[model samples]
Target chain A: MSNLSKPIPPAGDQDALEVEIRGKTFRGADGDAVRAIDEIAFSVAPGSFATLIGPSGCGKTTTLRIILGLDREFDGRLKLPAGGGRIAAVFQEPRLLPWRTVEENVRLALSDEDTGRDLDDLFAVLGLAEMRSRYPGELSLGLARRAALARAFAIRPSLLVLDEPFVSLDEQTASRLRTLLTDVWSARPTTALMVTHNLREAVQLSDRIIFLTERPARMRGVYDITTPRADRDARWREATLPALAKRYSGVL
Target chain B: MAPDHRADATDTALLQRPAALGRPVFGPRLVTALSLAGLLALWWIAAIVADSRVLPAPPAVAEAFWRDAATGELFFHLAMTLMRVIAAFVLAMAIGSVIGIVLGMNREANRFFDPWLILFLNIPALVVIVLAYIWFGLNEAAAIGAIAVNKIPNVVVTMREGARTLDRDLEEMASVYRFSAGRTLRHVVLPQLQPYFAAASRTGISLIWKIALVVELLGRSNGVGFQINLYFQLFDVAAILAYTLAFVAVMLTIEFLLVQPFEAHSTRWRPRRAGS
Candidate 1:
């Protein structure tokens, strides 16, 4: 169902993000042409949580980069309809400016119109209120991730992109951050497209999951979780995830 | 299970007890004082053994210093040298940083200018000073210009490296946020380059001052360098030593009072050393 070449007519829908990568090629160190992405097409619906799941080095990050407009050399199109909404991203690494305080780092994301808008509430939601004056280097890894999340959400972004924001963290910290993500996300719902390899994490956080194959990635399948987010708690995930994994066993 | 906090506290106390007992009796200031006194004693012994006019004793140098101070000659020359140093240092840093950033950002420009930079870097300080005096006709402008030119290449080299090593991740973050050019340069680019700026300034100050003396000796009518030149002709070793010592002390004072504090403040966000 997700293989359509054209976007779902983006004229009136300002909140949806449409991405189509016909091909993305770059020359490698050995001067050989390497195709990083091959004919992947997806659209994020308004205010929905979508995740792209794949193995490591599967061009997930490259896809995210293209969608975020960081890498414009790709032979593709990323269409965000003309509107008031902006784009924000949480990269794999917490890319906070080490020299600035947490407050400064977050404020750097704020556009002119967003300036002077009170952030105390947002900070409180992310547990970053007391951390406002501290530098990124002084913060623990978990705190740094939270700060990155805060920076992304600070802009009230219409389309949010996340690149494995919880990878490399301990299980406990990652779970807590996942919960914190949902809390912040629900407070002000936006169209979120996240990239993750962990299937359970995808199941826990996403409304739709788009699976991708290995390097030179192609879409494997797109799955939608019908259960309401509030109902998909520990017991539900435990009961449903094994069968779900089995269903996608070939792709996994 | 977590380790017992009470037991951990007791262990920490036991570990710290020996450190407290083994702490040195002499403080840093006292140690510095003793070292300087030992050096002075050694100098006095060397003077007695040599007993020559060339290697003047500590007392002789001090007497020369006092004589110059009482005559107001010391203040005038010191002030002259200080002014030249400040002017040249600022000029070099401003010109070098702009050029360095430009070259670093544009690969084509860097390729074009790389040979020019190397040429300037290798040109001896003496030659630059001589050329400046000859072409510009031995004025204050020439003297300051020569000193600044002598130091600009070093600043450019350091700042270029700093610009090249800037964190691309942070830069991408800035762009994704749609930061204005001014905002990105100030908040993202400049902070990353502060350490490099600090290094350039430290080296620039030392290099510029030395070149400034040469510039002064070649052309200027009044500075520590000129005074040293005047004493050189008379074979007055004591006078030359006095002037050199006074200028060195002032530079050292500036380093301690200004440069070190600025460096420390800029990197205040970095993880501090243990016990600092």
Candidate 2:
């Protein structure tokens, strides 16, 4: 939901490694072959939270996929930091194994060697201990998303990528999840990138917001969120976030 | 609001503690048993009134059953038939499951064998049995082989379709997590394939029995079908009806006790939908 069109001036500050995507484009299905994403570049710092906001069909999800190595056909050099640590993703859908229990789904993300943490504590953090044995089909949308969050965090990821992970939840549920996410992020600060069109959510959770253009999406803007993460409450809608929303609504 | 209510109800239902004493002894099952007894009494009355040899009285059939049982003829034939069916079923399942998984996993293998499967499925059971007898001779091996061959294609088709529809996301997740192949097969793939295995077992059991009977009648020297053929030669309608009823009873017991229970157990983990 962070829609703004202010160009990010290249600052001298260089605490984090930058992900530079040059001439990145994808071919569409029709013989006409329209570009879905065009040369999008951005940098996310270690332990910093960033959100990508764009109109529907603006290649926000596509950009995330390029980084995840899921879309190798796209043109460009998608550089990651040397000695790239494990990257965990929460897809737009929960994508939980329908046959598996909630705990089993979380356990699926853990490697055999990484066994320092107790699963119960992880489930407790997400308020999902009682629902551990339940299958995905049995869970409500909010609980399913919580389970997904638990699964991603259980990996102890160095980078967490989420694609509209809470879009289907009710406002109250989404707010609760946002608080849980921030708490989890605070506990073990990892570089986080979330894609969402919800401007309030972007401003509430992210350190910076990256906005993209309409269909052949390129970076339309980047806004350094001045709101301190500790002061932000997911329940309250901010007046300034809507101003950014209004600006990008026209450009997108 | 309705979806919220439904979800809350499911959560509550799942939270409820299981009964400590298990299910009560007296229930609808007892009522159903009584109703079945009542039906049998009515049938007995009708048979007495009709005084027909073709539709032999229940007591007369019972007497025939007793006579066969007393002579050990019933056990011998039943055991023989059951052994052949069991052997054929196990072989069919083992071969069918392997072939099915292969076909399911590889598109090229599926395409290669699909026409052959269709060809076998379409062929008459009688022709297949006769061909087996001609090729292998009128023996136990020939009879069992015929039944096994007839059953394999159906099992293969069921298992192949089951394998084809497996959740790709789960497979990818398994690979991402670096789950051992054995663990993935045991916990993930096998559980997903349960319904298909159940379907195959159900269909396979029914088909194998029917085909086994035909094989016994045409090629084998012993078993229920051979005995029925012998009774037909002697014009013993009572014996025939008794044996037929006995087989039907056996089939029903197998369905309720074996197949249904197995199916239910395998699918117990699948979450029930609201209003289901």
Candidate 3:
């Protein structure tokens, strides 16, 4: 078990989110009490990437929902960043409107039509250039996921929340999507929080990693991935995450 | 379940050769035309067997239709009935859709009015039409109001189901992006409800026309149903058959030309389920 040490950011970034969760208890359909999350607290600096890694059913998605303000029924305090910018989320499913084409789905997030050129560029970058007219039902799951990403980043969100974006894809497609995500995030820097189960993905994409315990979720461990983005390659993950895995034991 | 020959032929035709736009194969159309010819033959035989003026031959009814249409009386009555249908359909859809969305969005309102909706839905169209004429005195307003009231409750039920089935995940997407209410409605809410609207409008038009006929017969003059009643009093069987066939032709035109195309446009994005 890790000790409760609040993540204090640099003195200048004092206004970033310091999420202090006291408890979140939910009852199952049968009226039996289920402890989904016990107690947790952490802080994330503005404009940095943080990944939450935990076992399946550890309520990582729940915590993301709480942060996004979709699930306010949870317990504890979420100190949103000062002067909150726009927030956007990519849920586990694409959740695109089946009737709307890919372009329409992406355009739904955009309020200013002046970003038309940028939208075009975003579509090209995501390999969705030719798919603009196709409906979600027509696209393969990977393409649909890319369309989802386009919709998320098209808004130019200040706080982009991704919940297991690469789940259930072929490893090849997942890597491609991850690379696209990295390029897009680099082009438009935003504070992002991702929930993924893949340790290698957590190590490669995040500035810091927060490991969570199983149900009645609490912070199990936190690690800083000091490898810079250009050098955070597969070798680096192979070299580092196993040692970190031992340090956090079974949480990873 | 009973076998549906049209659907069976269309399905095999779809599989063997995906036609340009799901147009039924020519074989089925020929079959249908022959089937209709056979129906005419049967009716002709029946009229001969009865050998009474009660059931006139098809050619006599055709002559009656030609005479009525040439005099323009049939067209006039059809126009009157159609005008009432259009008015009642629009009014019911507008008012019922608003009430339904209100009930769906607000839990307390839904709780309060759900029972009332059930009560109104169960009320008979005839009773409502009679009550409307009694309360408002056989005026055009009462006639249209009665038809609209009979249709509104059904629309409410349909639209309420539509509102409830709206995807929550997409709503959360809208919220996380902070989309404006107008944009949310146009892009998110309305698209999801398209199928429901399609269902409502398609069925609503059918229901409105039937109720309109009842109202016209019970109260109004110079409409198809009223004209039919007048012919009935005169015992002109050939005229009755001519009017019925003309009305059926108009209804078929509306169904095939208007409602069917709209249905295709709305649900085109989805894949073909079993028989559609």
Candidate 4:
């Protein structure tokens, strides 16, 4: 089956996450202590998409890192579901190997369960089919971003984490990529956590949006979206943007 | 660099590369031939002006090269030196990379061994050669050992920097993808270190070439260095130049044919700058 069509859940259930952050602190390089996150707790039920929106540098990326088990030096209880499913991430940067061609980069993410059949379709879906043989250095930032997405999705991830995946992109490309992301995402039943600065992106794609406070982040609110992500058209976002903009005017 | 995409590396398959540089049919060899001829012309003129046998003319050196090569002594010594060089290069690279990777990967290890690395880096190559001979006596093993020992610290420094500068984002991507250790090393780690490896190898060959000669000259009875020592005692400047020129020609061949091509291949993914 094309991983582009729909990803098979490692567990019958799409992944569930229960996160609790009491006090996460770290010592900086100069030995000064800083509190990054504080009492920012939230959860995503199986097969739901959630976005963490906060002021820049309010530890949203750090929170994603904590969930992915990349950072352990924190006081937190991040309880992911039991079944061993693949976890995939698209970091803020493309982070692709300059030497490895796009195909090889995607191949590195394949697991035992992955049949390696969806590569072509995945590339085609992400607008990277023709450029699969090119190295990362040979790619533009937009194309590189698509390759990163292809690599993440190639593994048939149960837990999809995107950390500012569309930052620094022009609006046209970002819109196209976001649409591409939502189409690919909605095709499969997977739990996704995204750290984004875009309010419209959160409103359109997320089933729930968790608003976080300033540094040493604490959740201000978590709003459940009634509109189906697939059905969220331009009208829905047009109507939704101003209201949310006014609502988060003080925090954002 | 880019206007000639087809001429350089285009959509060529990387692994099954037939040629290392993918260089176009150009005058690269011709340029080199011209430069060598120029050097020989200048040397011939200088020899004529000096009118001294101490700096023998090109023909005199070529005759010496022919005589030694005909006697088979040149081949034997060259073979011996080549073996020691290859053996030492491999040994130093292996041991130095291991130590370097360890120090780079672990903070505790770096803290413990950094001072030692600095100390060895500052030590003279001559000091290492004499000490190795003193410790192990004048044998082939001691000669090879001295060259490798002198080489290890530099390789370690280079590899350590390579390991340290490894991209953390890529590592996180590897972990998030759950890449196996073997696969990660092959794909994610090794490619990042290619430039550093090239740096180490380029510097290594030049350094090892000089050191191995000294090691041979000091104690060993075979190889280019020992042969040069014998020619020096006889004041046979022609013989010395012949052996030296042969060694130099071989080194230059290795540099152009092997090192230059390998470097080009390693960094092929990098985008070209404007013009040549």
- Estimate how well candidate 1 is docked, as a DockQ score: 0.76
Query: What lDDT score goes with residue A59 in model 2?
Result: 86
> Could you tell me how far off, in angstroms, the CA of residue A165 lies in candidate 1 after the best superposition?
0.7
lDDT tens readout by residue for model 3, A79-165: 765446567788899989888899988887776543353577888999999999999999998999999999888776667789999
lDDT of 4 at B90: 92
Worst 10 residues of 4 chain B by lDDT: B1-10
DockQ of each model against the real complex? Answer: 0.76, 0.27, 0.60, 0.71
In model 4, the clashing pairs are none
| Clash count list over all predictions | 0, 3, 0, 0
Lowest lDDT sum, 10 consecutive residues, model 1 chain B, at B1-10
When sorted by lDDT, best at the front, the candidate numbers are 1, 4, 3, 2
Q: Please give each candidate's TM-score.
A: 0.92, 0.80, 0.90, 0.90
Q: Indicate the residue-level lDDT of B163 in model 3.
A: 91
lDDT of 4 at B7: 36
Arranged by TM-score, best first: 1, 4, 3, 2
Best-fitting candidate, measured by TM-score? 1
Docking class of 2: acceptable
User: Per-residue CA lDDT of candidate 1, range B1-276, in tens?
Assistant: 111223334444434466555355665567678998999899899998999999999899999999999999998999999999999999999999989888877899999999999999999999999999999998999999999999999999999998999899989999888899999999999988898898899899988888888888999999999998999999989999999989999998999899877876888899754332
Best by DockQ: 1
Identify the runs in model 3 with alpha carbons over 4 angstroms from their true place: A1-15, A112-117, B1-26, B105-107, B272-276
lDDT of 4 by residue, B217-254 (tens): 99998999999999999999999999988988888888
Better of 1 and 4 by DockQ: 1
